[model samples]
Target: MRNKLVEFKHVSFRYGDDQPWVLKDCSFCIYENEWVAIIGHNGSGKSTIAKLMNGLLFPQEGEIYINGQLVNDTSIWNIRKDVGMVFQNPDNQFVGTTVQDDVAFGMENRGFAREDMLKRIEQCLHAVGMEAYRLTEPHRLSGGQKQRVAIASVLAISPKILILDEATSMLDPKGRQEILSTVADVQQQHALSLITITHDLNEVTQSERVIVMNEGEVWNEATPRDIFKEKTALRKIGLDVPFVALLTDELREQHIQIDNEPLN
Candidate 1:
C-alpha cells in the first residue's frame, strides 16, 4: 500500500463568514506518488480544494493534515514546501524575463547558492525539454513552451507534491497535449505526487483515481472504469461523458459486439 501523504478530515471552507461552504465536510486521502485527478464543473470546489492543500486558503472548519502534521500556521510553511502549485494561466505565472531566469526564480526564493541555482535551472529546463531556449525571453515562447517553463519553475523547488489547477485548459489541443506529455515524463522520472484539477476528462484517462464533485460536495469517487459506467449519474451532474466513451455506448445500443468497455 502507498503511504498517506495528505488527508482532509471533515474539511469545510467558505469565502467568508456569510458565504456558504464551498467545500462541505470534504474528506479524502491522497497517497504518496499518486496521480489523482479532481474533476467537477465550475464552482464545484475543485480549485478550492487545491488552494486548501497548498495553504493558500485555510479551512473554516475541520482540519487538514500534510504528512500527518496539522495545517495550522505553525506548519503551513513546511506544508507549502512539499506542495508546489501551477496555476491556469501561463502568462500570469511568469516572474522572470528569460526562460532560464524564470526557472531559477523559485530556487532564488528558497535561498540556494548561485552555483546550485544555475545547475538546478539547467536541470529543470532540460527535464521539461526547454533547455534550448534558456536565454529566450518569455514573450517569444509559444503557449506550450510558456506552460513548460511554469512546470519547470515548480519542479525546480524539488517538491514532493505538485498541483496543476486547470493548467492546460487555456491551451490548444496540441499545446495541451505537449504539456500533458511533459507532466507524465516528470511524474514517471521523479515519483512526484500529482493533483490535476481539470474539466477535461481526456487528460485524466489514466489517472489512478477520479473524484467528481458537484455543488461543492464530493458527488462520486471511483476508478475511471467504474465512473465511466455511470452514464446517467454523470449526466445528472452536468458532465459530459468522454467522447470515446459516448461513442462506445452508442455502438452498444446498436447491438455492436465489441468487447471493450468505453474509453478503457
Candidate 2:
C-alpha cells in the first residue's frame, strides 16, 4: 500500500468565535503519487481544506499532518516546503519580469545555490514546455502560458504534493486543456501527488479518486464512476453528472444493459 502523505483527523475550523464552522469533522488521507480531485459548490469549503493542508489556516478542533509532521506553528515552514500550490489567478502569482526569473524566484528565496537554481529553473521550465519562453516577459504570454509558468515555478521547488486551487478556472477551453495536459505530464514524470480543486466535471474525470463536499462537510467519496451514479443526489446539491453518465442513465431507462460504466 502507498504511504499516506497527508491526513486530517476529525478536523474542524471557523473564522472566529462568532463565525459558523467552515469545515466540520473532516477526515481523509492523500497517499503518495496519487491524483485526487475535490469538487463542491461555491461555499462548500473545498478551498478551505487546501489552505489547511498548506498551513495557511489551522483547524480549531483537530489535527492535520503532512508526512507525519503535525501542522503547527513550528512545523508549518517545513510543511510548506513539501506542498506547492498554484492558485486561480496566474497574474497574481507572477512576481518575476521574465519566465526564467519567475521560475527561479522560489529557489532564490530559499537561498538555493546559484548553480543549483539555474539547473532547477532549466529542468522545471522544460518540464512545463515553457523553456523556449525563458526570456519572455509575463505580459507577452497567454493565460495558459502564464499558468504553465506558474506551475513550473511550483515544480522548481520540488514539492511532494501539488495543489491546483482552481488553477484552470480562469482559462479558456484550449488554455484549460493545455494546462491539464502539462500537469499530467509533470505528475507522470515526477511521480508527484496531485490535488486538484475544481468544479469542472471533465477535470474530475481524470482523477483516480473524487471527493464531494457540501455545507462544509464531506458528502461523498468514491471513484468517478460510482460518484456519477448518484445523479439525483448530485443534482440536489447543485452538481452535475458527467455527460456520459447521463447517457448511460437514459439507456438504462430504456432497459438496455450497460455492462461497463462508460466513464469509469
Best by TM-score: 2
- Residue-level lDDT of model 2, residues 36-56, one tens digit each, is 899998989999999999899
lDDT of 1 by residue, 71-182 (tens): 8888888888899899898899988999988888888888999999998888899989999999999989988888889999999999889899999998998888788778
| Model 1 alpha-carbon drift over 4 Å, by segment | 247-264
| TM match of model 2 to true structure | 0.94
| TM-score versus the correct structure, for each prediction | 0.93, 0.94
